[model samples]
Target: MTRVRHWPTLAVLAVALALPHFTRGTQTEFAIEVMITGMFALSLNILIGRLGLISFGHGLFLGVGAYLAGFMLRHLSENLFLLLAAALIVGMLVSALVGAMVLRLGGVGFVMITIAFCQLFYVLVLSTQTWSGGINGIPSIPRPKLWRGTDLPAWLSLDSEFTFYYVALVGLVLLVYGLKRLDASPLGSVFSGIRQNAARMRALGYPVRRFQLIGFVMAGSLAAVAGALHASLFGLVDPSLLFWTTSGEVILMVILGGVGVLYGPLVGAALFLALFHYLGTLTDHWRLVLGIVFVVVVLYAPNGLVPLVTNALGRWRGAKPSARGAAVALPEDAT
Candidate 1:
């Protein structure tokens, strides 16, 4: 029964793995972007959906990863593993430092502090034009090699669009799987407790702030990984990647897909990218149309499109919504 229940997720994974073969030209690139962005959204959702923390400056971590990767590739080696490791380490360290200060605040204060940090990084990057390329941005970053100083098969090279797509798809799958496991563990229970009732969790002797800090660091690290992938994909890093607006865009993706649902980020990223790509081609004022559609979705599907669709499917199949599993449900509110 458990295996049967996971068929949908497996099918989605299969489709993602096969996407590059079916897509051509810009569509292939767009699909890669979708996967990367989905990863970023998922990371952010860990804090927003599980911990009830809304960060308006998550893009700072993403930018950090991108710049770090770009700098390493430009000055050091093109080994993909090394780039990601460097990015992850730097991301965690930065997140730890920032989280220490920001996690002490709650609600709107937290949000504002995050945004402030993001903007500060943006300005710093711009000011350091010698390394960051200033307003023009760094460009022509070489694609990651399969392995540095090793003669590998050409197919394994990330320089190819098809190869990179699969690499990104695999990364996304791993991220989703790992996060799901985390969400089902005892630690996830504590995260939910904190989200639903911090007072109760504190009363129960849990280190609520510590948990929140850990979540923040984990999310930041993953976001950085996504950023490194993004930099590798585009061969560029820019201050805009660290801007507050970039974080806002990620937040929108999470909300549009359905916060707290395991697959929400994937659905949301696909939808958001599809709208931006297809609509922008048809009209100069695509933002207006996009905004209208977003408003409509939010007004109708308050919890998010993922939950709405899952509930509808559950009814059609003659199963209670709860039978779908904890992955689809919102974290329980403490009584």
Candidate 2:
């Protein structure tokens, strides 16, 4: 029964794993973008869906990761593991510092403060041209290379798009799995409780602020991972990465997909990017078209595409349960 219930997830995984083989050129590049965007959406959902924190500046962490990775690749080694580890460490520290100041505020105050912080980071990056490369942005960032000193097979090179796709795919899988475990744990339950009723949870003796801060840090770290992946994939890091608009796009992905659903972000990212890619080819006013589509979706499916599809499928299956039951009963009678 458990396996049956997971067929959709398994199917999605199979499709994602096989996507590169079916795609070539721009399609493969787009797939990598989708995966990275999905990672960002998923991380943002931790705050939006799990903790009810509507941040308007989550891109700050994403930028932090991208910049950190870019700086390391330029000055240090292009080790994938080290880049991710550094990104995670720096993301956590930054999130902790910012969260300590902002988590105390809720509602609009929180949103404003988050946006302020993101803008501050953007300004700082622009001002520090010596390190950040200013308005033009850092470019030509290299991809990871395996066995730098040792003689290895040429096919094992991570610089190839094919190899990098799988690396990003695996990283995303591990991230999703980790997040699933976290979401199912007691800490996740506490986050839910805090989201629903912080005062009540506090009355019950839960340290609400601490838990929220921890969640903030965790989400930030994951966002950093996504950012690092994005930077490596694009070989560029720009101030725009930290802009509030980027954060807005991530929020849009979460809401468009379905808040609180584990795989919703992936769905949202795919759909959003597909629309952006296809529509941009047709018109310069793609945003206008996308906005209209978003409005329609919001009106028709407030809960999100994933939940709507799930509910429809449930109803369709449930509608014929009596016949299924009778069929099972007939086999038992024959036995």
Candidate 3:
């Protein structure tokens, strides 16, 4: 029975991880963004869903990570692993400092302060146009090597667009697995408790502020992972990376997919990217169409697509009862 309960989730993951090999063309870029966005949304979920904190400057970590990756590319080798590590370290250090200051605020005050801080950082980056390349963005970032030294057939190169798609997918799988395990742990329970009633938690002797700060730092670190991957994929870092619009977009993605569930972000990201890609290609007013879709989804499916689909599937599965009992009904009368 336990296995039955878990199989569907595992199966969904397997299919998602395998998606890159099955699609081609415009899907390459869209898919890559979805994967990266999935990570971003999941990281945000830890704070918003588990800790009940809203962040409006999450992109600051992402932008910092990306910028660090760009800077490292100049002096260091273009190894994906090294670049990701550097981004994470720098991101965590920056977020640690920023979280200390912002963690003192609550609710709307917290949100606004976060946004202001991110903008401040963004302006500072812009001021250093010589190093950050200003609005033009860093360019020509080398793609990650697939295997250390063995060369592959030209067609099977990881330097291609599809490679980023698969890398993002793999990263999502690992991130979700780790987060799910954490969600089921005792730490997760305490986090949820804090979210439900921070004052009570403090009275009960929990360090609410410290826990929240840790959550923020962890969320920032995970977001940096996504940003590092994005820099690698896009080969650039710019002021736009720290824009509030980017942070808003990630929040929307989380809400559209479902904030609390592990699979919700993946489903939301895929749908979000697909819509953005097709709708943008169809008309210049893509945001208008997207806004309408967002309204409809919020109104009709407030829990997001994952929960909605899971609920529907649960009903369908429940509606189909076993037929074995009916076939053996005669035995009941005999008894």
Candidate 4:
């Protein structure tokens, strides 16, 4: 019965698995970007959907992973495992420090502090030319190999774009699966409780800050993983990747995708990337169209595109509206 309920997810996965077979060159690259963006947005959603907190500087974590990965690839080695592990570990450390200081603030204050942290790193990158490549950013980062100076077979290397696509897809799938399990765990309940009433949770003696930091670390580490993948994808890491606008774009992704639903980021990323790629080909002012669409979503469907689309589909099927990103709904196993 549960399997019957998840047909759509399975169908989507089937399509993703077969994506490379159907598309070539730019289209395949675009699909890769979509998966990467989806994971990036999913990282931000960890805080937004689960904790009901928004961090404007979340891109800082992405940048950290990207820059560090680029550095490691350039000066260290192309070992895939080492690069990813380094990125994730550094992201965890940085986010732990940031969360410890900023998680104490609530609402707007928290958002502002996060933005401040992001910008601090942004300017620091600009000023430190020897380390981060300054405004020029790091370029021509190498793809991941199995390990440095190891006799491992080349099949383990991620040199082929076709190979990396599967890797990205697998990473995104694992992240979603992990988050779903997290939702079903006791920790998820505490997060849900904190979302409803932090004060009540605190009264019950739950160490709210610790849990928030854990979520932050999880999201940060994943963002780093996304960043490392991105570095390999383009062989470049731009300073703008750390910009506040990057965070804003991710936040928009979360809002456009249903906030609470685990798979919503993939949907939103596909739409956003399609619009971005197609509209940019037509005109330079593509952001204007995005801005208009964002305003429409905000003014009309504040609950997000998922609920609207799902509710319409549900009406045809005579099922109830999916409680994706709804503030009041008790979060289910996934959403």
86-193, model 3: which lDDT tens digit per residue?
777877888899999998888777889999998998888878888888778788776665544546653344477666676777788789888988879988888878
Best of the candidates, lDDT: 1
The sequence of per-residue lDDT tens digits that candidate 4 reaches over residues 1-335 is: 99988998899889989989888888888889999989999888888888877889989998999998898888888888888889889989999999889898887788888999999999999999998889999988878886566666656766666787898888889989999999899998988887777777888998888888888898998998898888888889999988999998888888887777776666777778888999999999999999899889878877678777777888788977766535233222211
TM-score, predicted candidate 2 vs. hidden true structure: 0.93
**What do the candidate models score in CA lDDT, each in turn?**
0.86, 0.84, 0.77, 0.84
lDDT by residue (1-335, candidate 1, tens digit) is 99898898889778877778789978888999999999999999988888988899999999999998888888998988888888889999999999999988887788899999999989988898898999877898988887756677776678888888888988988998898899789998888888888888889889888999999999999999999999999988877999999999888888888888888877888888888899988988887887887898779887778888888888799988763322333443311
Higher-scoring candidate on lDDT, 1 or 2:
1
Query: Where does candidate 3 stray beyond 4 Å?
Result: 146-157, 161-163, 319-335
lDDT of 2 by residue, 1-335 (tens): 99998898899889988888899988888989999999999998888777888899999999999998888888898778888889999999999999999998888888899999999999999999999999978899987665564465654656677887898899889889988898789998997787777778889998888998998999999899889988988889988998899999888888778877778888899989988999899999988987987898789877677776776776788853232111000010100
Question: What's the C-alpha lDDT at position 191 in model 3?
Answer: 80
TM-score of each: 0.95, 0.93, 0.88, 0.93
What ranges in model 4 sit over 4 Å off? 147-155, 324-335
**What is the alpha-carbon lDDT of model 4 when measured against the actual structure?**
0.84
Stretches of candidate 1 off by over 4 Å are 150-152, 323-335
All-Cα superposition RMSD per candidate: 2.4, 8.4, 9.4, 3.2
lDDT of 3 at 93: 88
Candidate 2 regions exceeding 4 Å error are 150-152, 319-335
